[model samples]
Target chain A: MHPEPSRSLPEKAAPSLTGWGGSPAGPTTLLRPEKMRDFKPGESPQIARGMGRGYGDAAICGEGHTVLTERLDRMLSFDDETGVLRAEAGVSLADILTTFVPRGWFLPVTPGTKFCSLGGCLAADVHGKNHHVDGAFSQHVTSARIIPADGAERIISPDKNSDLFWATAGGMGLTGFITEVSLKLKKIETSWMAVKHTPTKDLDQTLDFLAIDDAENPYSVAWIDCLATGEKLGRSVVMNGRHAAIGEIPLRENNKLDGSFSKQKPMPFYLPSFVLNKFTVKAFNSLFNLRQGSRGEFVTKFDPYFYPLDGIKNWGRMYGKKGFVQHQCVLPHESARDGLRAILELVTESGRASFLAVLKKFGPEGRGMLSFPTGGYTLALDFANKPGLDEFHDRLDGIVLNAGGRVYLVKDSRMKADSLPYMYPRLDEFRKVLRQYDPSGKFASDLSRRLNIAGD
Target chain B: MPGIEGTALVLGATSPMARWTAYALARQGWDISLAGRDVQELRRIAADLILRTGATVSVREFQAEDLESHEGFWEDCVDQMEDLRCVVCAFGFMGSQDAQNEAPALAQQVMTINYTAAGTILMHAAKHFEEQKTGWIVGISSVAGERGRASNYVYGSAKAGFTQLLSGLRARLSKSGVSVLTVKPGFVDTAMTFGKDGVFLVADPKDVGGQIVEAMTKRKDVVYIPGFWRLIMFIIRSVPEKVFKKMKF
Candidate 1:
């Protein structure tokens, strides 16, 4: 037989990397494997990174190997009859949408940014606007091929290796390097979304609007005015959407099935840190409320409805070089109102002026042990990195803890290690699975280390 | 506009550049035969291309270093696509210069895969295209072949020989209605240069692939990816050999 092609070691480079937040940057050895055959567990304490879209350090393995899966992206097979797709973990949701949307297929659940990798979605168990109706991303994942520290590849699914599968669903890549994933795709009639915008005068009305069970609309999200206090506390414009039927789209428009959207010019450079102060943020928030709230009801392309921020490339750079931290937490239905009010009041009193504030209603708890979603209301806020921000976060965390809520590890850059157990009652079970699969703790990240999810 | 109705055979189909090129061709409504050593990998690529573009795709086994098997490989490709109109050669070995310096076999293998075997396959394609009197042959040579640098002279010399081969074939087939386009890509962001140091102005394989298809449609004889590389290579070629030998790049 012809000699097997030499297994040339995958390329390696030492580069200073950061998550999308741009803070907590560290030097690491990055191994980029281009083909599936080339993907191997090369170093201890390694993690897989795709697009580095995670807000914090979930994808970073500081001073260790960070296997970049971007180049390994390739859609292996697609069954049009069943709408099932088998793709490499590095494939971006944007790529999948570009390929399948015209074919009348869409992702069952997609986060705000389509730039995220499938593996990252699984690791974070990312939830979408439809979480209240559907669930987290892992719920649709049929199976995945992962290579742990031992370099032995295993196929884990709900029916087989069920514990490992559950642990890996939202295990944050601490379990292994996810190489490939197979997921079910949602079918759509058109590329447009029939959306309705309802303006709420206060937090109570906003929560009420979000809690409404509009059978037709499968997706809903709210853009909150974090700066508004007192009477207008938590003023928001809730946007509800569902895939538009072909009959709903205008006949005059050409290419009804075309899902492509215009991309905005990238942010040229990092704005000065002072550019996002309280006054500017308040003005922007007010303008946004006016513009979006007035839209009322309209049919728009799926891109703007699902991934509005993705229109501007590298939009995170708008937060400036020091970067910003996004604090996203979910409070159960019983405590959501009080918890969100306390959190918003804290922000307004501090005059921090969060640039973006969002809230979404989640349904039943997910099968993933560490998944962020549950029967709750999740609120996310972004605060610029400035002096005393950590202290501010600490206070916010305390409020969440007192309300019996837990921070989203994917969005979190700073959360006390001690509070993790209380936040996630199943942390011990997740650790037990990690110990069984990677007993030596071969996988680690800054977030995991900071939270001590995997013991030292 | 739809591409001319025919199939394009892409050798070394598993390489990042070749895969991108195949995608560009498939997007233009061209049927494709993706030939490579890894049939399993090629099948995956074939399925992907079909899923994305809905183009008819077939995979064939092609070992670049198997000199004796190339003629039969071309025959099989022709059998699969009776209306084959184009062939793209996009495979090469870029062993590290330090390793090539220490190992004679490695250097020999690099030269053989990049030049000798490549030339043999192209010769078979040239004969078939010359008889058909209407076809395109695109070879991915390198800008390093323009002026050999001490850092990669071994790889550069093989590409230089391949470039010369394409030049001769172009001249010979000029009256036979066959066109040959030589591509001189600078640093491409593929697996070959994923983490290599000092690689600048790297062109994306997708853009390069698109430009190659554009060049084929326009029937251009030679083109540099990104176009700016033409000037870069010109300046390097203008340098005197006496000074170049001592100057390290």
Candidate 2:
């Protein structure tokens, strides 16, 4: 066994990282063993972490040592024609996009953001706007190089270690730290998008439209007005799109110049804590809605339409000192409308305003045990961190639970520990697999503690 | 009579920080009013509080920019609240600094929104809280205000003004039972930070919200969310403007 970083023996630990949700409390020492040979059997750091992007505290190492695999980022191989990419767990989606998108390829599934590591994608079993057709990110994943607590780095897939494989999917990085991942990438003609925007009256219409037309589009999402009430509640504009064909491209210097889009600027500083009130948001939304509806049909560049939120530099500073919270939940198909309505109604009643409220339909269940998607409808609402926001979210959690839905663990901040099982039916199986790999009870996070997922 | 006995008003209550601060306070059993421009949305927020915390909470249509509506709204809020404990300002804007530099009008809009309107409302809130004497006023400030950088100077300048304003207000209010807490948060992960890359030590609104409540309950003077922001801003501010401007922050 290799010498421990600080302590000789493992301890009950929680792993913390700057994940998409929040930073969680984990163990103090984060050990990094360079190669698989360097890892000795039965000498684990208690827990392992990948590129920390499981939103909440799912990947945090609670009260024990953690093994960071960021240095393990490396490309193993690639299948040119099939666009099959096999890379180490540390490989970031951003890295993949920068390298592949320009080569006429894209991720089969991606979250709203693209900063996640491959291991994190598997841990959270992430999904994307195209989930209506392509399903979760795990659907594209063929296999992984997982290093279990026992210090064995082996390639795992559905065919081999299928139980452990599914467990790791949505497993929140519990089964092991994925060292490598092989995934299938979708081929595209060019870095252009053929998008069609449709403005809907409210949530009902938005849902109806999505149900009717979601099948036709590869990427679809609706931006809802969570603050709208009465007749206008859930008013939103849906943008649906597919990759543009090579022959359809119009010649433009900027578009054709480098065959890639320009990098977006970052918001640099915090604004004074008074500008983003209801008046401003309403006005902005009004203008935005008007623009969307007025534009009619136009084939614009892919970057702006698909990632408008990405254009702004350091936009978070706009929320001022306190920051904001995103309450995202996915309800099964049967309960989607009611779940959406209830959540929206709660937000409306609370008078909390959201600048961007996104709604999407997931295509299928991923192989990961704790993965987020399960053929359902997902909605994410962004709220500024005013006082009493937690109470508001807790009430939201109740509404989510009452509707037989659950908050996405990746995006949750206020969910009750007991409520997790209600959302994921296969919790017991996930726990069992986690324990099998980590019998020492290492590998924990504040989310796991808050939701009682692990560290019992 | 206008102020509730144990209630606090949250300006821009829907902002992530404001919401979190309010949540932090509510945990201590303090009644809260999640005030914002949308009356309908405020009421919903109030209902949500009632359901979650079982707190006697309510909401009102509060527009800081609409000076004319202030008196009546304050009066209405006072009538509903039992023990007006505090007023928290968690409002701000970060319009593109480049856009502001290009369009002088946009710069004015940024300053007016952050300094003029928000400051005026805070002054109004201070008067109420000061008169009550047994109240708290927590204003969410930012480290950017430490020293304006060209990257987002318009926004930074406005925040600087507000930060100074809060500091002065705190100095005056210290003697009174009314406590003023200034909160400076660094990077935060929200819709606003949707596309940001390589951001360091960013915080979540819920965490900040929890911290805000903790500060309020503890009655601290000034607190920094994610703590490291304090050190970060100190170092940033310490750098000479000549050197600071030369280096990309």
Candidate 3:
């Protein structure tokens, strides 16, 4: 049964919001609710927003309402012996790491950024470098409490309300407002990682290092130099890491599980647009290769190992006020090599230098219907927002579609509506679940509206 | 570091600042008693604290507006935890200035909760701590209390009363070996200022909570969260009265 509504409505304000990419800004009514009871649906359509790390329009609703879940963060309970934790969906992965890492526990699967809230992780079903080993974030979640359109709270798991569970797992907050989540955490001996970096000569070698059976480490990802061409195309630095055992660390580092790391320095202001062009990015790429290629093996803290960019707060501002878009797509194993080569060649030809490029391998298809991962190779590239960037991305999407690949919904801001069906074959199933739960489309976002995911 | 062996009673435990302060205290090895109007919410917070810190947590229903029951509430807290050595008052009401200006009742509610109710309970705490001759009391005041402004002077006036109350109590108990900390936070990213405009240099509640704990450990009397707020408030207080009255900030 539904609980009583809160005596007063949550604090509301109209704020101009944007995703992490910073492009496509719009004004939306934001509701900051402190408790579950305050999650009352109003006349306008609504979607839940966490830390706004989705990189696109998924968290922005425009004229609709965006219910912020950050304040709802609280650790509900934990099972020390079993390494299971129940926490409010608004709890950030950073908080979890701070609280549990020192106690010898770690997140089973975490995205590149720890600033993201648990609910956002579930909505996106985010994957990490260890996705080939541990699967997506939602796969580790045992159960969740969600407040759907009807305002009734439902506890869904993989076995109970399995359809709804799968739908909400990667539904992008389309099905409900995720309030709480319970997940199994991984146990670790230290808060550090033993990392090995190997520079690949070309695209083929990079793919070989990330091969499913050939992968020697639990976490693996490659930073590709997208500006390369011909024989040097896709030259990358492959980084592989595993949890450092107590014995593997130095004697002076006595607190093996010390989670404390260096503080973040804010990117004081937006760098001028001209500051990051092809010439500059290419130079930076060359220097990075030279510096990292020599660092063959080392022990590093988890913060820098997993989230190198997080060390610079608001690093996205470097993309300038106009912002940039991240296009991440996963191609099926059979056509991954060809697909990646074509995409890289196009990026090099277009002169849109992507300063940050990452490639990883995925395991089997995840349980979430719209989960982005599959047994394939995934590539993520960031491009500055320019006049012709939309047409450029369209061509990239065309190549991915031909290769039987799908674009990650969380990172997409301007893909065509028709591309949705081609990318996610399970769109019909996601739509079916939405119709059953929220027939009136109470929960909608700019992403859903642009792509017509609700089929309204 | 070893855990502190005393219990801390946190009033208005459901507020964001109180929740974080309680967490900071519990993490430092202090048992906690959470009191608030919403008993259900307090229970959830207590459970969370217990789970995270392995500290003993007790939930009690408290009505800040009911000044008469505060004395009994203090007794219950002392009865429940014999080693209660810290009391934190982290509760206040911020009514809309425009609405409070129109309704006398609204203004009264805001004044009573932020000043009268808070002051009454703190007096009881002051007596108990003074008698024990070894305890700490923390009051969460605001920078708004430092000056009167047209934007939120009603709420500011109440906070001003609270700030002075803490100041007076600190003076009265100076030689009693009991310490009182007056916390003046500016633009904290809490539920109270979640969507408010013109909020710059917003400090995270977690950091503010951690700083409060540090200040208490050092026995600091008055502190401005983020530290820079002291300079900002100092500049504001230095403005000439005629100029300040005409300025909108």
Candidate 4:
């Protein structure tokens, strides 16, 4: 039987936990502060971080002083004319999208999920659909207010403290704490997206389409069926898009809210574990494939196709008791097919079920030395945790390293210690920068330790 | 012939309470198909069930997140539980809230496992049970869900949502002759409660299992594993927000 891990919390204490998932933990004498001045690393918290989005454990405070940034959310400045925005580190992308998407502007970059704080985005140097054209969040980042390890606050950027700037860009909040940030935003003509959808018959067809379309579309992605093997191994649907022209904008009330304003109800509880068996998945996949059949040039709003998941609040609750692990990796184009094939084969042979599998064509390298994209094909799959999950992940990790690919830090929960260096060649360079700011190694996290990102 | 003698499909058959409840009912003469993530573990447990109850049993690998495989999983297990009578859902997670709070990825893991994944399968089971018109569904809930508490509140809140969903299912299926029972247990001594200390008057897993079986047989609306947890939770819920906010659980 799969053993469910449980632990007790200190009695009579109010527990305060903050993560992107809003997960509850045991009681602790911890507090979350919304204001930057309220946090005195020496007095209230030993360390401060913004937006706990690190997948495994990097942002978590281990039985120590923890500062949460949920309440620290405030947009300080935004130049609508120039598309320049400045905000507290705790400001979330969702907040920004809701406030600014319709104002003929867009974020420089965004991850798959838009729930991250601006500071968290800077800390991870996050990239997105436009990574090929725009680069990482750090490229757009102009300046930041940092609280160094020496307990001093200063504004650092590429021109000033360039050394600390690069380190803090994707430093996982180790170099120093980011209180606020200044960054450039992209200008858009309309809130609608001009999207083109192409359906492929198999894995090979999907890869060929990606290779050909990579040069044509700035944003290109394919959703594959991992369960299909042989001829239909990589059968998928390719979705390529760009911002819609003002003339192409659909007529809707409050176009600023975009077509994504509607909220989808949440699936309230754990489904009895049996509903997700092979038969159900196959039927779902077949129905999905059939439903996605060729629908010529469709003028659609951005929300349904681009952010179908965003509609459902707390959609992750569907995975049930043992949480799921999303394994996403980017392999060089040379090894893309083999790398993806090996991973999918392992999962299917092992009977691992994945509901969502996303395949995207990444462009050039971004600002962060360790950022995931690098002009390669990236594949992401959601693995529901079950027995032998650790072993299964270990096997996948081996495939990743062998292909000279690395798992995305934001989505990974299980990767071996040795795999980090192979994934990112600039590990030592980034390490040196982190050490200069956090010499004592006072700032750390479980993800940093697991992946050996932060050195002692 | 009475109460589905062919074979009972136990959905989360690997859980502590699920196993006990399955055994309790299987001993009373129902053949069992124990399905969960680790079929090897189910195999190991299946042998013991065969030895003790001398009833036919089978084990299958079923994952809630693997939405791609659910149809085949059901097909394979359907013949074994041909006229399935009952399904017990005891799969859940209270992952280190600390771990979840530290990682948005981790919190998504907990939320998915505790709510979405479980909800998906429960909905599937409800559909099948409705068609059969003679099956029963019993799920393990917690008193912590009666109201969101600061400690384990993420899990508690998820459970609260689950309790409400099951309650609605019970109401909807009452006419269909299918019974959906919500089993809300308070402080059951199992692996799930391993680390917590000073838990007041916790009941044993076996006792909770027995109560669930009794409730299922009697077709009770909603049951508190120990009965008193219901009254205790009622009092806890009655506390005014002004006073409750000041006083910690």
Q: Which candidate wins on DockQ?
A: 1
> How far in Å is the alpha carbon of B35 misplaced in model 4?
62
lDDT of 2 by residue, A1-456 (tens): 111112122222223334443323444444554333332333433445666545455655545455655544545566877788887676677667766776667778777656567877887787878887877887788887787776677778889888888987877766766767899998876777777778899888998877765555688888786767888888888878777776666876545312344487876877665777777877888888878856655566656756576577545567775666678887888888887888888887777777778888777776677877777778888777788887898888887788777678777767777788888888988888878877875555556666777536
What TM-score does structure 3 among the candidates reach?
Answer: 0.94
TM-scores, chain B, all models: 0.97, 0.91, 0.97, 0.92
Q: Model 3, stretches more than 4 Å misplaced?
A: A1-15, B1-5, B146-148, B197-200, B226-249
The 10 consecutive residues of candidate 2 chain A with the worst lDDT sum are A1-10
Please list the C-alpha lDDT of all candidates, in the order they appear: 0.89, 0.71, 0.89, 0.71
Q: Please give, for residues A1-456, the per-residue lDDT of candidate 1 as tens digits.
A: 234446665455556588888886667778877677778776567889998988899898887888889877788888878888999899999899999888889999999999989999999999999999999999999999888878899999999898988999889998898988999999888988899998899999999999999889999999999999899999999999999998888776566788586677788899888899889999998999999999999998899888888888888787788999999999999999999999999999999979889999998998998988989999999998989999999999999999899999988888999999999999999999988889888899988998999865
DockQ of each: 0.55, 0.01, 0.41, 0.03
DockQ of 1: 0.55
- What's each prediction's TM-score? 0.98, 0.60, 0.94, 0.61
lDDT of 4 by residue, A1-456 (tens): 223433232222335443333333323343454235544344322344455555544566555555566545556566767777777777788777766775667777777667688888888787776666666789899898888767788788889888788778877777777887888888877777777778899777888877774544566678777777777887887877777776776676667336245567777786655667555776777676666646534656655655667677666666665556778888888888898888878867887777778887777776566666777888888766667888988898888888888888766666877888888888888889767766766666546766778755
Candidate 4 C-alpha error for residue B60, in Å: 68
Better of 1 and 3 by DockQ: 1
Docking class of 2: incorrect
Whichever of 1 and 4 has more TM-score, that candidate is 1
What RMSD does model 4 have? 22.0
Residue A169 displacement in candidate 2 (angstroms): 0.8
